[model samples]
Target: MGRKKVLAVIHTVAYGKRLLEVLSLLEADFRLQVVFTAPPHAFGDDVPAFLARLGSVVLPWAQATRMTFDLALAAGPRGVQYIDAPLITLPHGANYLKRVTEGPNAGVAGLRRQDLLPGGRLPAAVVVPHHAELRELARDCPEALPLAHVTGDPVHDRITASLPLRAAYRRALGLDEGQKLVVAVSTWGADSSFGRFDALLPRLIGELPAPRYRTALLVHPNVWAGHGAYQVRSWLARCGQLGIGIMPPEADWRSVLIAADWIIGDHGSVSLYGTLTGAPMLLATSSEREINPSSPAAALAAHAPTLSPTHPLVDQLDYAAQEYRPEEYAAIGSRITSEPGRFNRNMRKLMYGLLGMGQPAHEPVTVPLPEPLPLNAWAPGHGEVSA
Candidate 1:
């Protein structure tokens, strides 16, 4: 049989990152040729550079949709229905948490009824992380429910799989014995942690002594791509000077999450997914208007302690841990994904089935999360690595 071609529709840097995780299953198989494209998106800034860094050949959005392919995969919904191939669409974030602010799909997240059925068409499959999302799809886009599949979350599997290496991860991040790593994460937009608490990183740096607490800032890739890298760096210059390590947009954030002793974050996937790392979590921000009330992200906001920017940062951190309940957080983790450690296996089977080909003759591997990026090095010294 001829080698199959796959088109990966990367709508943004964030989606590209998630798509890369799913694509890892395809790496060992030499029978497929995969190309990429960055459809027009507000956060499509760093996509070409990101793909170029990987030495990936990309076809322009217009040109790519015109041609036929064996399969097409996308993490976000942006001009995907036009692609001429059997398409599989996955959520960029682990849960369909965010409530859409505008457009025809407003009030709901990006998964629009029209997106699921653009002019009486449906994607070959819609992969959701949890079965609960199937209900959401049924209510929002019932016609697309039959096409929905629950393959589980790659990020959920990776974070949970790396828990045993937590100590090693801490060491790689330069966290000495007795030092706690406080990772402050934020999703993009005005409702994110950074938006609600602008001084969160600096507060963590200033209030908590460097010897006892090491601080790191992990923002969504869309934040970096939305405002040019220069602007985002400029905004965080003071925090950087104070030694708050800003994680690179493309870095493996799972490493940071794994090593983290305390995660103070907003209503983002990384924050909610941080529960699996065995680290007690505290909410740095929340947006009732933005987060779906029934979604898992919202469920976390309901359970975890909310960090007060004005209050003593260390005291709140102490309180959160002291009041932590593993059972509650574990339940939240359960909601993130149904199939534990099976993302690679299930995705590979689905892809190969679409290709009408036999299996690779070996067990599909769930690749381990790598060490934290040197660019996001967290230590006592005051240094910065801006993306």
Candidate 2:
């Protein structure tokens, strides 16, 4: 019998990297074709090359209208099953295309209600990142079937797998021994009207007592595009004048994060990455109105030292970090890390079922949470690690 074909549609490089990683792991079970919205550039350039290296056929769809419908039509006649990962929503131009061109057996992975119709029927199965994301999806869209919550994000799994090269990474970044590194990551929409980073950045940078650690300010591409690189460079110049060694915003942020002793940022997926690296995360938000607390990013901050510029929750931050042990971190990590394999297996089974083939003999993998780690040891000097 011929191998079943699957079309994995990834909207961005981050999500593309993730889907590609899982596809690589499941390569033997099915024929995979990757359709991306655009070819990666600048910081995201590594993703497509990485996917190509994994031996998948990569197709770039550039025009929004043609990209959505044409790609689906091209894949459909070839008997390819469709899967949407993370942020590939049904709204925008894709919605009409999805309805017109999608094969009968199309599915959505990591789907949430906000990404679909208000009363829409759930797809074949929903892929989630963790229990937290699953809970949020359930609360928001109860109709969706919980096909699986893969413990690990493919991107994170790739990141964690590279941990052994830390020393070499540190050397490449030009870091000296014993000089502590702190990474401050900027998020998209961080400069919106509700965001007070103009005031917050200066205060945060001023508060950092230097010579103890070197700070790297990693600006988001969106922010750079909005304000321009020259503006970011000028701001970093001001930060440097204040004694903070601002790492160029153009550097590969994942590598920078890997080399950091700590991370400070607004709530984002990067915090989850920080958790995997065993780095202390200091979350800096502008105000409660600026972010949704129920968000996956916020949920991550709830379990860590999240600080808001306008509303200081210092005492709560201190207590949470001190109280939660390292074993707890390990437990959380394990819970989130175990999901990828199960997701891959289920995806394979779903494709087979859609193809009218007998269900694959794939079993879902369950990963037990690890014991909490000692929080006190990593907590005390944590304040000095953030901007």
Candidate 3:
């Protein structure tokens, strides 16, 4: 039989990367087609450019909308109006990253919280990262539940799977045997570590002992697009001149995480995911203290030590290396990482079920398909599904 044609739509680099990784698992069974939507906001202009660096096939939106396919997949809501096929939403930022302290505007300050569906844009299947996320979706957009599937973030599957590639990645970076690797990750905005560090490369070179420590950078794609790639590249070149290793925007962050001994970052998913590695994380912003007490960002901030330019970097690193506890970060890990073999299986089950194909090879998960709940179950005085 011919493979099913699947249209994968992406608008942001983060969503693009996560959806790409998940789609890779279905390669043998699906004939994948990709479409890149125009950037919707200020930082978006860099998305297609960033996707190009990753060697992705980005169809023009005009052409993408005209194409026909059996299944459509996306990580963002922007795809809702474009694809005619049964839409599947594999949301990009499963962990909430945002200005939670900022009242209504507190929804993921950097990127749109793609998981929350609008009143009328429910997809055929919305794959969420965890049960808490599913609960969050139900509370906010229960209309999407009938189509929701509680599969852990597919990116976590890629991250856990990349653990074995660490040594190879280190070698590719030409690391010496004994040097401790410190990766400073900068997400976009003035609040992030990249923005906080005026002379980031120099500060890192000065604070971190060279013979014993090596520093690398993973700047967010939005930063590149926002600041202009030429300026970002020029800065990276300056960093390279100072003997700092830098990961290009296109580099898989999981690879960097696997090689990192410590991570210094601001409020973003990189920091959120870094916590899962049990590495002592130093946050560059104090804004995290203002995040909603019940929000995931606040949960992460409970453990991350705030970093300041004047703080003693080496002393903190040493203390963290010795005192870091994996158990403290386990809650975060549980939310992101799935049961080892469950992600692909659940994806296959969902796909096959949607396509009217036969049963998938994987066994059923412990949680049964969720029943549509009353709005009162989560919030008082709200109505049921909007349709």
Candidate 4:
């Protein structure tokens, strides 16, 4: 019998990377076709060529393709209308932060209403990151519960697999022995944690004490959208001059996440994902100004230290480093990511069962990963590694 045809639609780099990671493992079961509903500029130049090497026939949403697909995968609501087949909504990020306090249908998830489904039934299943996600989906869209599956995220699987390489990652980033690293991640917008860093950076750089503490800035892709990549890189260059490292938008932020001693960021999923590493976390309380303070990010912050520009940044980091709690971090990480090692098997089950292809005995494949997309990294005169 011929392999099933599946259409995978992607927009953001996060979604593209996760879906591709899983699909790359299922190359033997499915004849894959890809469509990028997002603008070409939103992606790096390497994407198309990378997909081509995987034997994917990239299709433009407007272009007519006579081939029929048995199933379709989309990371967001925007990609839903662009594909034709039984749809599966596999989210790009775990929406745990905004939903807990604001309810399930807040932030990026509000658009993914059950009624939006074609014929209100095409999405045979909704692949979620964890049990918390399933609960949120049930509270927000109960009708879609039967279709939901807690399969976790492929990225989480990849992140878990990369845990043993911590030393190698730190080495690649050029960290000297005993040098403590702090990674501050921003999720975009003027209200994001990254925005608060402009004034805070000087104070942090002045107080953190050079030879002992090293810092890195990770900006979200939406920031690149608001202020083009070049402009964002230029703005980040100033931070680099102060002996801070800049994490390029196109490169995987996980590299920094695994190596950092403590993380300082906003309510973005990256903050939640950081908990998985069991690292000490300090969230920028400024994020609560725009987003709800009672949200999951705030809830997770209850477990970590909170940072505000008005507060003593250095003192807080020292305190958090000393009094970090592993149990609390593990509890939060469990809620955001489920079945870490078994994600691939769960994904295979969901896809095969939903597609009515019957369960096939499948094993994970080791594919050669490409180099990081060519993004301009900021390297000031200081001795800092370029991400």
Candidate 5:
């Protein structure tokens, strides 16, 4: 038989980057194609580009509508499988029904309840990173099967590899040799809940004693694009006015992670990477409960200090993240760093399994898989599976 072809549909650069890393390890076993919803326009576009250059076909998101299920069905007959990486459901909340019914690309677009049906015709498998997400998907689309919960995030792996030389990294970034570095990776949200650094900026600046520690803020591309360069410039100006040495967002954040003495940010996989790198980290929670932490994110928070409005340090700095007791953080952190190869190995297993190559023999790590919830429990209207 010929090599099995696999197409990975990813919604963002981060997920695409992880897909690429997994594909890179399995290039010898299968033919791979990577489809992205947009170009790599984020802080970590390098990984995505590298993967595309390494023989993964890039399909424009706009052009995807023309192909439809017909294309996937044709490919399936030839031993090709379509895999949708973790995708956020569109039209979130009350607007969901109205938006799906009225959108230009409405009526059974992308991966939906109908696609997972026995003869409805979709890919052989769909890969979701977190069990909570998988449970939600299963509840909404019962026909879909639960694949392995492969926890390996390429971004986390990249960040982990850079932690050892953090001191040298600090010196290279021109921060004072003795001063500790605190890095904050901001996120973009519809409400000001996650991205509002305006209140926290001045307070964090005041908390750090000049020449004792310096803070570097790495804003997500979505936030920077939405707020513009002027917002960042203004923040930098304020830091300068307060005698704080602000490091401009010029370097790739993975390298910046290498230089960081401590990290603080809203819930995201980046924080998980920080934990894997063994960086002293903190999480800023969302007031609106918009940002939900993944398993790894929760695992990392279990090890690190979580800053919240109630903490004593909350008054010292105007940021928000639930504090993780010292013992919890240490326990979780130790487990993550103990087996560096667990993530890579498991990811390889999932990729190979999707291609029907059977599972490879590998030592298993004690990563717990959360219980899968029934589909009917979440969305009652989705019971009629697509035929």
Candidate 6:
């Protein structure tokens, strides 16, 4: 045989990023031929720009499906069902917690019967973060049970590995010593954090003491894709001018989550991940049916305090901090990944096993996230400047 071939499918900004995290494990292997395809998605913005920076030529979707590969990897189900190769479906976020709010396939986010076990056909494998997800899969798509594997969460692993670098990450963001970072995080759709507390963005500037607090935003990549980056940035321009810096979708958000002292978010994956920061989190919004009640995101929502607009935002932030106990967040954080640091190893082993290839000889390494860039460094666009 010449060499094994692999195809990476980019379904959306979120799915693309998750694929890269897992693909990083196979990067050093020269025996593999890998190419990527940006599949059509409702939110496909920035995917081409993201893939272009890697200096790899991306195969167009139509051409990609025509070619054969040893294995295909996808974080979303968008175009993977058509690929003529063994496929692995990875999680784009925490535990497939979000329910699909619309469309015919709309049901549980990840366990859509038509998507995973289309016409009673199963993907080669479906990798979930925890065993709890297996129960979810059983309830939703029992046909996928045997195909499911709990290799743990790579995103969680990266953050767990990078926790000690918190101080350095904070400094990289240009935070003054006394300033506590408050991150406003939101997932896309009408039930997200910004969807509810959008007015709170402007309020952050007026409510909190500037010297003691630094505000930033971590908006879901899909939101940026749905609303053009220019428009998203423009909408929040005034808030940006006041103080809050927006974390670009492509930036290593784990670093920002690491640096945060408070997390004001909804039931998004980031809030679930925020548990690791030991940063007290306040849910900016909550909808009865937006998330699975048993999912980790729900566990977090059930425990974390809701942000009350009637109360002073600062007082809520203060109360969350003063009443904070590591054990509480730690319990929620534990639900994220049962295998923790084993993600890289387990994933590598599973991929190599499927590819029928041998593992590399070198010791495994988890690269620490690089320092974050300043807000001004990634200005949404370079407006015309006077010479």
Question: How many clashes (backbone N, Cα, C below 3 Å) per candidate?
Answer: 0, 16, 0, 0, 6, 0
Please list all clashing residue pairs in model 4, or write none if there are none: none
Which consecutive 10 residues in model 2 have the weakest lDDT in total?
91-100
> What overall lDDT, based on C-alpha atoms, would model 2 receive against the true structure?
0.44
Regions of candidate 3 where Cα sits further than 4 Å from its true position = 1-3, 30-41, 47-58, 99-119, 289-295, 337-341, 359-387
Per residue, candidate 3 scores C-alpha lDDT tens digits across 6-26 of: 776666666666676666555
Instruction: Answer with 2 or 5, whichever has the higher lDDT.
Output: 2
TM-score for candidate 1: 0.94
TM agreement with the true structure for every prediction: 0.94, 0.57, 0.81, 0.81, 0.56, 0.94
**lDDT for each residue of candidate 6 in 1-387, tens digit (9 for 90 to 100):** 587889988877788778878888887788988888998888996888777766666999999979888999888776676788889887888777778768876778878787686446578888988888877788878889998888988888888888999999888888988888998899888888878655777668888887788888888888888988998888888877776787777666778888999999888888888998889888888766788777778778888888887899999999999988899889889998888888888888888888887899875577777777764454542211100
The clash tally of candidate 4 reads 0
User: 150, model 5: CA deviation in Å?
Assistant: 3.3
TM-score-best of 1 and 2: 1
lDDT (10s digit) by residue, model 4, range 248-350: 5445677678788889877787887788776788887445544434345666866677775566777888788888888877776666566666777888777
lDDT values, one for every candidate: 0.81, 0.44, 0.62, 0.63, 0.43, 0.81
Give the deviation of candidate 1 from the true structure as CA RMSD: 3.1
Alpha carbon lDDT at 47, candidate 5: 32
The lDDT of model 3 is 0.62
| Model 6: per-residue Cα lDDT at residue 68 | 87
Candidate 5 per-residue C-alpha lDDT over 264-288 given as tens digits, one digit per residue, 9 for 90 to 100: 7655534545554445566665322
Higher-lDDT candidate of 2 and 3: 3
